[model samples]
Target: MPDPIPATATPTLLYRCMTKGVKDAPESFEYGASWVTARRGMLSVHQDRLECGDWTIPYSAISQAVLFKTSQMLIPCYILKVRTATDSYQFGLSGNKFWSTDLPFPVTREKGRLRYSAFSIIARVILIAALIWYFYQAWA
Candidate 1:
């Protein structure tokens, strides 16, 4: 009888090969560029300001796609060291799934984070007040 492949070995093989899977881009995701191509995994970026007025944002994270689902997904990975140049930004990210809708992609993890801008808050308040005044006048 043929020997059964060990569960431990399964992951090793998966890491070495790509799988055909379904992909999606949620409407809430907006960063870099996202698309469902023939590949699986995510690419993360970081930027360094050079003295020449150029930006160096490299793809510094690559992890194996541990799970790919329509809902919550998870990837066990780490970011690579930044690669910088005066005229460009170069880095590499390799994981099992490069793009996913499950969980947060590498950079989009900040979507739910606390970002308080006084200007933004003030703008919202003014807009709301103007809207209320318009409606009140229209009704009166």
Candidate 2:
């Protein structure tokens, strides 16, 4: 056999991210079967595998990868979901990294735009009304 690749070699693509959650993985995979806390780490995409800390998933095992946005604290947050045959991993990624083209699997966008909650709409209306009232008070 030939020599193995050195660990110090740089990956094809790398991003600093937080591992949000995992689906279908064993309870011991991370915090548990699912978690609300995010674990900070560096996600690297190699030619044949994806690595994040101790987790190494082969490219062939990835069924799909989806890029989506959701509202968090009234701000849009980008997420990347990587699905394998038996498990799915979710990562919180920056918007610029979401458009990267180095991955073996294609990343598809969510079907629709980020939907605002009723509470969000109500909050916007209240803010606008407050602004109008303040302007009227100043003019008067």
Candidate 3:
């Protein structure tokens, strides 16, 4: 018989966003540049590098990850809350709906969209400041 699914385990779903023939078939779903981690019990995921990041509490923390195959392609999948057996686990964009996978992210709450708009404004201001600084330095 298959192992029972844990009750505390939450379902997180990610959608694949890859276009055709861009990524090598073998390494298409795996990420080389970025990774994600979920703070225990918080439904939010944060991006960080593999080596220089907080230790993820294995099997307890869940992360929904997607990697760029190109700017146009994405490989999305749901990673089961699993204990880290090895030093690193290979993340694959498997289409498997193992253990009753459901998209943990809710459809409601447009908070992210609003937050991104705020970020856009802040970024514009920072760019403007940087330009001013550069020009001043050049004229000085």
Best by lDDT: 2
Give the C-alpha miss distance for residue 3 in model 1, angstroms: 42
Pairs with backbone N, CA or C atoms under 3 Å apart (clashes), candidate 3: 16-76, 17-73, 17-74, 18-73, 18-74
Q: Least accurate stretch of 10 residues (summed lDDT) in model 2?
A: 25-34
Backbone clashes counted, model 2 = 0
**Candidate 3 local lDDT, 1-140, one digit each (tens):** 22333334434312221111211122223322223232222122222122112334222332322332111134333332212333333232233343134333221111111012444566678999999999999999
Per-residue lDDT, model 3, residue 88, is 30
For candidate 2, give the lDDT of residue 46: 68
lDDT of 2 by residue, 38-80 (tens): 4566666566777777778787888877766654556565666
Candidate 3 local distance difference test against the native: 0.30
Query: TM-score of model 3 relative to the true fold?
Result: 0.21
RMSD of 3: 15.5
Better of 1 and 3 by TM-score: 1
- lDDT string for model 1 (52-127, tens) is 1122233333221222122213434222222223221212222435333342223323212222355546667889
